[model samples]
Target: MKKLFYLLSFLILTACGDDKFSPGIPDIGIPEVEQPKDVDSVPVVEVPEVPEVDIPDPVIPESEEPEPYRPTRKIGKTYTFDLVEDSGIDQTKAIQDVLDKAENGYIDKNGDTIVNVIQFPEGKYWTEGFDVGLKKKYVIGLLNKEFIDIEASGATLYTKAPGHPYGGDIGKGRYSHRRHFWIENSKFIEIQGLRIEGSNTIQGDLLGTTKAYTPDFWKAGGLDRGAHGDVPAYASYLEFEHGYAVNESQNITFDNCSVYGVWGDGFYLGNKVSEGGSRNIKILNSVVDFVGRQGFAASVADGVIIDNCEFKRVRRAPIDFEPYGATGYVNNVRLTNTYLEGFHGGIAALGRGQVNNIYIENVKINSPGPDISCWDSAGKTVRENWHVKNLSRVRSYGSHVGSIRFKKTNNITIENSFVPIAKSQSKKSMELTDCENVTITGNDFTNGLYIISENSSVTAKGNTPKQEIIIE
Candidate 1:
């Protein structure tokens, strides 16, 4: 029984000795399962599936936004003179303001701002005068070049009287010897449909007399003493009151305008000999009446054209190409379809200055003096190339001698004209003195005589009445 008990203990010890049943050793073959510790543990969580959505961006305020860009230069603009602003008073300041604004244009998306067009309303505007264009240089390499158009249809610019105080000279109460419209050192200016009226009493018939010649009146207004002669007295009194005075300008045009009761010429184109002269000036469809001097006059100019114009009651000739300076000249002038009446002379191109290439076509003159006169002064003889065609209705008044006269000229041609006999005078239709290459043809000189003297060459043919040609 002791042997059986030992064997059983040995068997138990042997079973305990196996590594699979040991306390510190783990089983290698079979996996162990984990069991839950508590019943209140966290439940299983299932994530929900969300649908896709579109969201918009946030908006910004206008104050925080950026502006679009703009260019620097701009094109020419048109400005109209405010009738309300420039009314019932001296319109010099208001008119000048508009001119200045137009001259200095605004900038925008267009081209360079250089040209401007100014328009005025229909009314009577009293002014002292207006001066425009650059008179001196500003910067180096900068030219006084700008284009301006003045559209003054149905507008009248009335000048201050001789005794009235000039606007430029307020305290002095003197008449300034300034033009009504003075344009100098400019290019490409056009003035349209403007009427200019001045306050001069001397008309055609009252030239040499003391009709309105107030010597103390003019002297108190800062005018020089007039000369002794009748015409010179009145002429020197108000010599600078021209309707329009242009100096050293180019490509200027005056269209559909009228000048009445001006003290000086209707238009005066002059330039200093040191500077370049005026060029390409044109006056078309205009009228000049009751002026103290010539209708159109130039001292040193080229390419002047006067077409479809009428001049009446002028103190001097209707058109005068007489340059006053020694080195001055008038060249390349054309007068077409013009009428001259009630004047001292029709057209005169005589001075110490040189005159060349004048053409007159379809000109009708009814005056008391010579119809057309082309001559040189006593010592100097440089006038040449005068042509007159289709000149008719030439009626002289008060026993004036010759209807057409030429002296000391060269290359003259007078054709297709009509001249009536002087009834109470010498009955001379045409006269030539010291001329060269003169041609008189196709004219109606019935009961009229041709007096030729010291002419080098003359051709007279195709004339009516077959009058006798006298050569002296």
Candidate 2:
């Protein structure tokens, strides 16, 4: 009876929402009820008090020391100029004046003209790019002993409106007549320590009411005047949005430079109209950012090296060896330790041209589209001899897109890569069609099925998730 009386009294007190309730107990109030006749003799109960616990305030340390200042690389002869005081066009003319007055163009033992050193100080000089010729457009020469040295001391050169005239069309046999940093048929041109800005402007008015593409009749040599046709024979041209165009040049180097905000490719190295093809070229510690097309596009080249470069936000591929014309044969190209992000395709060599001895190692790819893609549109036995290793894909979207693709190529190898798959990525990680002698080894395809091949010349060894190899 006493226990029952105590239980009823406890319930009644808890229902009253009294401040006397213990911390651990819920303060639920109870409605008034008729008292039982024998409830007067109930004993009161008390909850043990929780010991007053204390928590100390958190301690925050002082801010970390500032990172050590690293200096930029210094090379070649250095000069100073003020861009804020002059218009971009005037600044270009000023730099050209310096180039002209620095040294007279001289002929070397190889019968090539040489233009000596030109260095611009740290400033943002805005203008269209420049054209460096041996003597005339058709003249042939070798750049002798550092023939043209341009050192930009942490400076930026931008292309503004009414920029240089159109240089030429990309793959097709067209001509823009205007030039944008058109370094023609020469050698030993070393440019370094600069950033190029295209400002995303096409500058179509630079044509000045002239048509971009020549009529078919004009191209057939039927539009000849009393002399010769005033129009270039092949007259289709891309817009003036190129950052650098190295045409039929050899032994050229671009070091510690950057290109950004261009409507077209950042770099175009081609041999469409040149007397000779490009050879022994290197692009080192460079960056291509925010370009509309390929970051670095080359055609008809040999012994090209791209090392320690970063490509960001290029709408197309980061690196492409594209042969749009018959003269396009890319050979002996190496890309090492390069990083690419935010591109449709990471790397590609496309066309019906001979591409050989291409090596890509230590490449990181994270893009919205295919990380690596190669296609032979012409369907000939054109692409060959490619070796790629140490590829890493940091992120993966769903399975609709592929990480790697090869179509109509032969003798390719991809090894030592990390391809992590998520549930969202249901598509195959690799796609190979009409490829021959493909070797895949030492790779991690644990999260996703590896390859979906159409034609079987596929060899696979030493890949993880071995039991789950899906061959469709």
Candidate 3:
């Protein structure tokens, strides 16, 4: 609904009369008459044929690019719920009404149990000391975080207690059990525009993996301190639409959303080194800002994609790939249109993956340390292959490693990237070691020596055709 829609009406105001005013060959004097007098006034002046006006291209505001895979329109029968329904829901009964409408044999006017669009009407609704539980259920709807606010005592969604099988362990882990909204074992779930604030977790990660960086958390390459589970256990397989999980658990998506001001990460999608791990995840159009630890993190996962996301003021790597104590390998991951600003702590992307096939492109990172990392390994077992393009980094602090480091990595290639590092950060800009099938081509290294290799040589000589770099 745009303003000033009535202006278009004037375009259709060319009414006409037949024989009443049809001037024939009028002279320079005032035109005798014409069906359209306005046309007669200028036509004697040999008015050039009017040209059709070209409509301007519609303005496309900066927005989150939607994944083409999702069903653009609603999927199922549209179900609408209001805290102020016929049920007359007040503060005490708002959450209860929503829950009762979601579950408990509530159907729409068309007898459709599967609600596709459960909407919260536009209003400021409050719930005091209310508990919303999603023990194991598939809910599909846009939870508007802009409109809903949950108190400290009220839970948006909870899976299980600490010791229960539902691993939402915040204390024993990191972001466990603190479920403002929990989804697991629940596939094809879409939650959008939901804000989860001022919540606490008992034992888990926000997305579904157990808490990490604590003593018990162990995957493959040993993360010293393991964390707990953020959400409850058994809540696997979810698809977040536009939800925000702050200081919650793992195994969730923050698509077109933001997560901030938490004890943990904006979105930490990975199991600890001790556990198996989380997998097949995607986080796009999201922001992980002002948190304690990493932003858009993936510790023990496979097939992850974080695209068009932003991270600001995070403790650890803004876009981290920490696979501690991994077993098989971490593979087929990507991050595009992603930007990381601020060095709450270390590397922008701390990729310690097992195998290869980890790619990053179109990334702009500003940090106190290195931008890309493939360092830290216990043995010569796995070779993580990465392909990076259109990457830009502004380094302010780093010393032990290079901006584009590859220690336990192999089969990696970075092309058309700009790495401008401060000498104070490190005397070196790039380092390669113990890697095979490596190539660095057409990279703009503005500071420090452009290259560093250990027992390696260029595969081909002076091949700017595409700028290939090889480090054996």
Candidate 4:
């Protein structure tokens, strides 16, 4: 009875709590799962730190001022000429006295030949003319206390009569050429910030016509002061190698000056008296107006540059490169960034010697007459290798005549220029006579480019009126 009772109880327990086995048998099924071990006695690992890099600060630079121009010659001394205006003082003589002292070299009390920089203060000083002799490396400068001005009552050097002595001759007996400031044989001459005036209202005599030795006074005709003539040559500035063979004017500069109302040329170079002509001359930032003859004339020049200049109201050509006497050459010349207005002609190069390597660029010309006229040399004169570029006329129409007239020139280039004229106003906008090896390209012309029947070896490409390029 006890065994049946225990079996019934076990069956009841298995059904209620442990159905998978008898009531007490589940406790010993797995025995004991393996126990996990402790990690307290294991070895340790450590990570190293990265080192830092050092950076430096940046550095800055400072600007410095430019040094003043120091002339090569020893001219540590400065001398001033204070002339009295309207004091009945001959300002010419007063200025000439100091110039003579400078040219002759002033000996100090200590027996040292001190070079000087002669300066003229502001005053309306009247002078017939004053001359700067040859072989002077001194600076004839105008003192600009406030600014550079053509002072109404400032240093105005005036000339008196036609044949009168305004200034002294430039050189000794043979090389004597007259100018207000005649400079010759100077290694480095600086003329800056000055104004010169002449009486154009006064009737002037011809330079070569007034010789007493010849009875024929008007034989030379009405040539400009620096005109080139063949028959009974009116060449009088400096006869061909007439004087002592001095060194040509070199390293000379004309800056910030004004020249007006002159019966003669405003500025003249190419001393025929010297074997070597003027070289390395620079004319910059200046104005020349109302001259009876050319604004600037060059007979024989080697290495000349006319830059940033304004020429107006000139009677003859603004620039004349003709060596009137045919003794020297004009080479390596450049006219750049210049303005020309109201002139008969812009540039007329009748140079006897080879007028070669001439470059004219960035020029603006407003003329009522011809702009450029290169005279026909016909083997009599030699001109080659000319480059005219980037030139524009401000006005719509140039003149009744052709804008560019090329004659007897060779190896020329005219490009990137604009000539505003029409075929109705005349057929030829540019005329070339006896010219060869010319290339007219990239130009805007109103009328066509015309060449004579004799012109061979001429190329007109990329020019307007491409169909009507060569007009015989």
Candidate 5:
């Protein structure tokens, strides 16, 4: 019985432990494998630490930024002011109002005003006078900031009777008396293709006219104090009428313009109240006809260039470089390709002020009347010092005023020129009085004497003097 019971238990245990034979009992079949205890037997890997970095923002270019609005024209906006023919109205106030409005218009993004160009249509405009680039009340400050271009093609600006009467004494022993156009304390101004007509009809000497020579006109005009003997009151009366007067300005240009029948100079470049002077003035392709005084006169000026111009029937010299102030000077003047006819003189540099660096080339002088003075002291001190300098190539035809004289001058060079004898007058062709370091070469003095004073130091070479070379 014990053997049968043990065999039965063994059979039961073997059946329970048999693979895939258990039906209802829970079965945890696979056991996890244990890791190795020897950690050095396996290989190990190492890693390095990383550093921190900073990144900046991207940059922007200048072209990518917003641009300021620019006008279509080169300078700025253009303003047009027109007039009617024979209007018989004084256009001064209306024109001045237009100028004021144009000058003070809207400021752009570039901080510039609206006034750059002023245009006038074809018409005959009557005006008393026009004051440009000046303050409204006082004669101070500049009106326009940028350049001003006045285009008045085929337009005439005629002066009214008693025009610009008594402009009320500006300082520096000077008066801003009369001018068809006065440009002061400004720069980069251009007047183009305009005609200016003044009141005076007298061509030659002002004294020759019955209207100007009378004591009533002189007394009425407050010009009687300065007149003495044969000499008219030029200092007082000559300041009363001018086509264009520029004061303390710079870079002013007059192109294709005409100035006629003016009592004073056609163009007067000067300064007021010791305010430096006018500088870099240019007159191109212009005409100054029938003027009472000089065609173009400069006092306290520098860098005056007159090119392709004509001066006819001027009572005084065509060009005068006489400083009116005590501390004034005229420097760097160049006149080329010009025609001067029917003048009292050719060119004059007077006054006590200094005149330096004058250059004249390809100039033709025709029918200059009885005073052809080139350089004179004008009753000032007659010293032996050389105060004036010149270089010229001039040809004088028809009747001349005795000779082309140079007195108290230095560093003169007269070359490649012609000076003929005075018609019906026994005079020399050229005269050098109290001059120094003169070089007269390649000149044709036909049938006329070339006179040099004892006080002159001259070197005459390669000159054609048909008559004698006299040393006075």
Candidate 6:
């Protein structure tokens, strides 16, 4: 046949081109994209252009304000002793230069020493006490108030010897003593129009009665009692702003000046050497003279405020709130616009036990004896709420007035006051006992009379009678 039909058609065209050029196994079905001859000539899918991100603009700044307290020298009449070199009167380098200038001081850390707020430049300051002692809050301060004058030869200003459990009651302590300018427990403390008496003469035991002028001024505060006293336990607050301790020295103060003869006790609030009894004390606008005894006495004190203060001569009770030794009693006390003169017993809030919330307002008391009094009782019995008021009294609590004199006192009030009687309208202005809601209001007593001391309950309003209002 044609050579086996062309060799079987070339082996059947090489087995159908080897099964149409298949290497593994193919049935072939991929090639059909020809439907776009005019689908807008199709070929548009180009979305590649992401570059538009830049944002930075928010700036804000400008503010300023702070400055005031300028002090650039203004202390006149200046003169210095060639900046000190005297070794003679050197009392331990003048009390170690006031205890290293009150403990390493200021003015840009002084190299030689001397703290000047200006005004010591009149000349004549010899110095001593370089040994250091008596300075705990003004061992000395006389910032010129008519010029510093202590020299009757400066009568031995501090000599130093004190040391021993001897805080005072005498015995066991004596450090010669010399305090020219020593400030302790400091706090803007100032002494204007200065005088400073007894300039640390070191004179103890003046003997007014000795256990330090008694009422036990509070011995046993710390209880050493060797010579008979120790006291070291009462210190909460002590302030004498606009000062004038003039003389006699014993923790004193005189505001708005004109203070007289300090032998101690013009205005003495306790603690420290008496063991405890100092509380928020305010003696406003002062003028207390010749303090013979108790011009203003705040006992075991809690809160004592004596406003618009002024007293004269002072024999005993210009104003007193007990508890130093009748046995100590203190709570809350207030005496406003006070003016008591030559006093024997003007305002006396006695103590054996009770004295809480005592308010004597718009007061103008003149006394020979018994203007206003509270007998703080607990002995025979009877202790209760006793509150008097706006008094211009004659005699109150004379017969031992007490809200608690019977161990069961109640609220008592004597308001809008003024009591000046004792032409003996038969005396006895106010005397209530075992009280209970006793209110004697709007009183212009003009004179005297009120003795309700035996199981009382009274309520009298607008106590009229231009001159007299008596009740027994």
What are the lDDT figures for the candidates, one per model?
0.70, 0.65, 0.48, 0.60, 0.65, 0.44
The per-prediction CA RMSD against the true structure, in angstroms, equals 18.3, 24.1, 23.3, 15.0, 14.2, 21.4
Worst 10 residues of 5 by lDDT: 133-142
lDDT per residue for candidate 5 within 1-472, as digits (tens), equals 9989777766786678874544444667878799989999887877777787776777765677677666543456688875556545667766666666665234466665444788888887876433432223221122443477889899887753323232223454444355677777778778899898865543232221124234344334433233322222234434547788888888889999999876678888886537878999999999998776788888889899999999877767778888775467788888888887544557777775667777788777754442235453563433232222222224433343345676777787777777766445565666777778877777776656645465888877776664345677
lDDT tens digits by residue: candidate 2, 342-411 = 5455787777577778898999887666767677667765577789899888776445655777887789
- Report the lDDT tens digits of candidate 1 across residue range 243-266: 787788888899999988776888
- Winner of 1 and 2 under TM-score: 1
lDDT of 4 by residue, 1-472 (tens): 9989989888787778856657455465666786548686565787788788786676666677787644343454465776787624447767766655554234455544444566767766655432433322111322211111111223566543223222225353433233444556554556676676654422244222124322233334343343222111222322221101113566567777677665556777776635577788888888887665677877777888889998877666778777636556777889999987655667887646567788999988776666677763435775688999988777655355567877777888989887666545665667777778878888887554443334546777787756144546
Give the per-residue lDDT of model 6 (tens digit) for 359-426.
66777765556665665544432345546566664343233332112223466676776654544354
Candidate 1's C-alpha runs over 4 A off are 1-75, 83-88, 104-114, 129-145, 163-176, 201-235, 397-400
TM-score of each: 0.69, 0.65, 0.55, 0.64, 0.67, 0.26
Runs in model 4 lying further than 4 Å from the true structure: 1-75, 103-116, 129-154, 164-178, 202-247, 376-378, 396-401, 422-424, 448-453
For all candidates, the clash counts are: 0, 7, 84, 2, 0, 50
Leading candidate by lDDT: 1
| C-alpha positional error of residue 96 in candidate 1 after TM-score superposition, expressed in Å | 2.2
lDDT of model 5 at residue 443?
71
Model 1 Cα shift for residue 69 (angstroms): 30
Q: Who wins the TM-score comparison?
A: 1
Candidate 3 ranges with C-alpha deviation above 4 Å = 1-74, 77-115, 121-179, 198-254, 272-279, 344-355, 395-400, 424-426, 457-472
lDDT of residue 282 for candidate 2: 94
Q: What is the clash count of model 2?
A: 7
Candidate 4, run of 10 with poorest lDDT: 142-151
How do the residues 279-367 of candidate 3 rate in per-residue lDDT, one tens digit apiece? Answer: 56667676665544556555566777788888876555676666554353556788888888745333443334474687788988877
Residue 179 CA error for candidate 3 (Å)? 4.3
